[model samples]
Target: MVRVPGAKVALSTASCYPETCTTAFEMAADLGFDGVEVMVWTDPVSQDPDALRALSDRFAMPILAIHAPCLLLTQRVWTTDPWTKLQRAREAAEKLAAPTVVVHPPFRWQREYAREFVTGLARMQDESGVVFAVENMFPWRARGREVAAYLPHWDLLELDVPATTLDLSHTAVSGSDALAVCDALGDRLAHVHLADGAGSNKDEHLVPGRGSQPCAEVLERLAARGYAGCVVLEINTRRAVNRDEREADLAEGLAFARFNLAAEAAT
Candidate 1:
């Protein structure tokens, strides 16, 4: 098997969904993941840096990245203020020695936050010495209509962020070509959320090869480009019937990532 020395395949805690963050660390370690991306959400353990550090030590799994609490459901998490949430996320990443922090654009309704998001984020990154990789989001589709849910648009290319997180599932939902976006981002692409979708209005987060996305191609491209950033498995396992099922799905995702990433060297 060919290996890309700079690249590492990490497991996102969000993939564990209903499972606790502790369970995610255990699963990542059990499945031989290079590291874990801590998705800061409702899980109390996820919010506690010391607790997360304990789990990291317990499992010997490094915290590759920290995903800020920017989801709608996480509005109250960390705090109601969006900037504060990002600040806390940066702090967490720094404490855990993670190089990057994944954040989403402000919701359209948060006019004040959106107004200063670009400049604010730049300032935060400069002060913290952390890479705030802005994640691409998709427009809200309902009743056959598209709503511009995120301010400053959902497309990363349209924005002037220093670094970005290319989420393949979001690309699938937005009907954007994954390979093209990947190429366009180039070095601005500081992180990746590796998942697949079937071009549905809903974010499918399917296994890599199970969807229409060019998942393998993207991984291969990253490998060829000598991408040192983490390729995190952010697939959804909420539908898993049991712990075994979840573990199987995670294992499959890890295998897919490693295989495709190695394709570059094999050639």
Candidate 2:
């Protein structure tokens, strides 16, 4: 439980700028984030892994990247002749010296592929020295418990790993208490996906403090439980006006977080 905070903005690739990894790194570096989390697809036609690593190094931030099998990018879990794509992802993560790598659970592409995918990721973790984690899908059962029950169950099912992303907004969308989920995860949690939401079945990714979920309260809960994973905010970069807007949002989130952190310390 380290209370390590990291700001999350987007790269230029997704919707901000299509051909600007270097530009994206420059902008992300200016945002004062501890690390950059990237999501890439293993499909043959998807973005290049080499370019991703180059940008990560350019920004002087070790990578925290993800690779999920996507349909357009050949969304195959452990089957589907996905060796080429998986190898590419592995090589890229290694090259970037990324500390954490997230893989999609087998729920989306194939439910049966979960075991092999996790095992493969374990092997990748061993080979690359990266913390391999899998994100629990939206329809996971613990959504009923504000993400708590599901966190333990999800980790138990994974078996080999001991970390997760406490997506407070996703839990709220599922009609659950995000703080309670934090309690369930305890120290096994690795990071958080932060965003304020209206506590409905929506994932609009509202700016912090604008939606129903209290961002500061969530941080307080994490601190109380001695959970020190990264509190990385995720927003749609495509919708932002420019880098300045993204930075402003991050600044506000940081202020809100600092207040909660201080309160947590006092408590």
Candidate 3:
């Protein structure tokens, strides 16, 4: 088995692909993340899936996954039409052949909508033969760990293996138990979104080590448990002065995160 504590650092192509996927792959390759998890928004980048695939492969990144398009304004998941975002997501996955799709649960939808959404997601996962890793959102929260506090039901919903991505910082923001969340999750975790929060409270995606979280403790827990999954660094994009600045900051920040992971392993 692969080593624990020190995982192959991963990059979310969303960090690089805000405009085009080629740039995402190129930057990821040049910057040295072990692999990439991409977001296929309805923009021009996802419009051409094959190209994205070719680029990712060319970079020789071992793992490839996609984040399903989640429209924040309307919060639509799928439909029958051509512009049907979910349909396009599946098409993009098939064409680019990503292993999984990361999904975000709607925060304030009617209970019925969440049900239909989960059912629909399950069907899509079956048909596409791709893993659907659902992420937790506050059904109602000041932050992410609140989702963990309400976790037993959501855990059942995501019992399927490899269909859950643990966003530690988000959960921390929810004032949830990081170790408890990790414990309950076990092997179902396929990915992790990393950032630091001001304690177990605020949902700020501060650069790792720049906040109050016990990063070393969390890493130690994962190391001891032998959890092998992607750790995605999610610094807020809004603060980036420009694309180039974003790229530079993200590259440096991810490198630091990975280095700490190595340090965790050694300790």
Candidate 4:
């Protein structure tokens, strides 16, 4: 099998949702992932750096990245203040020796935070020495009308951010060409959330190659370009009936990533 040396396939802790953060590390270790991206949400274990480090040590799984608690359900995770949440995320990443932090654009309702998000992120990156990769989000749709939910638009192309995280599922939701966006991001693409969607309004974090998105193509392209970033599996397994089912899905996703990420060896 061909292998990409620098590209590491990681599992997002959120992928184990309905399962505890601790379970994610266990599963990642059991399944042989390169590392994991911790999604810091309401889970007490997720928010504690010491606890996370302990799990990492126990599993011998390095923390690849930290996904800031920016989802609606996690608004009060670190605090009500959006900036504070990012700050804490960066601190946790630094403490864990993770190289990147994934953050979503502020919601339109968070007026003050949205207003200064671009500049604020730049400042944070400069001061913290961590890559704050702004994750792409999609516009909200309701009753056949498109609603502008995220500030400065949900499309990363419209934003003037230095670093970006290309999430394939979000690209499907936005009807964006994943490859084209990747071409545009170029060296600015710092991380990847590898999942698929079928151009649905709902973000269906389907397994790679399971939906309509070019999941395999993206992995291949990253391999061809010698990408040295984390391709994180962030699929939804909450529907899984048991740990066995979830493990099966995770295993399939990991295999898909590994197979596609490998380029033909030089003859």
lDDT agreement with native, every candidate: 0.93, 0.54, 0.62, 0.93
Give the lDDT of residue 129 in candidate 2.
Answer: 60
User: Candidate 4 on 36-142: residue-level lDDT in tens?
Assistant: 99999888999999999999999999999999999988988889899999999999999999999999999988999999999999999899878999999998887
Q: What is the C-alpha lDDT profile of model 2 across 108-225, one tens digit per residue? A: 3444445466566566666666555555434434455443223223432334456566665566665566676666666656666666678655555666687877677777666655
Give the worst 10-residue stretch by lDDT in candidate 3. 143-152
Flag regions of model 2 displaced more than 4 Å. 1-21, 41-46, 67-88, 115-128, 140-161, 224-226, 258-263
- RMSD values for the candidates in order, in angstroms, are 1.4, 5.7, 4.8, 1.2
Model 1: per-residue Cα lDDT over 1-267, one tens digit each = 565748889999999999999999999999999999999999999999999999999999999999998999998988999998998999999999999999999999999999999999999988987899999999989899999999987999988999999999999999999999999999999999999999989998998888999999999888888888889999999999999999999999999998888544564
Error of 2 at 15 (Å): 9.0
Per-residue lDDT tens digits of candidate 3, residues 1-267? 323564557777666535466666677778887777776555555446766666777988744567776635324434422125566766776666666667666433334445466567667767877677777443234533243333223442344434687665666555566667767777776667776667544457666677776665666566666656667776555567777887777777686666555423343
Give the C-alpha miss distance for residue 247 in model 4, angstroms.
0.5
Worst 10 residues of 4 by lDDT: 1-10
| Candidate 1 TM-score, true structure as reference | 0.97
For model 1, the run of ten residues with the poorest summed lDDT: 258-267
TM-score of each: 0.97, 0.70, 0.74, 0.97
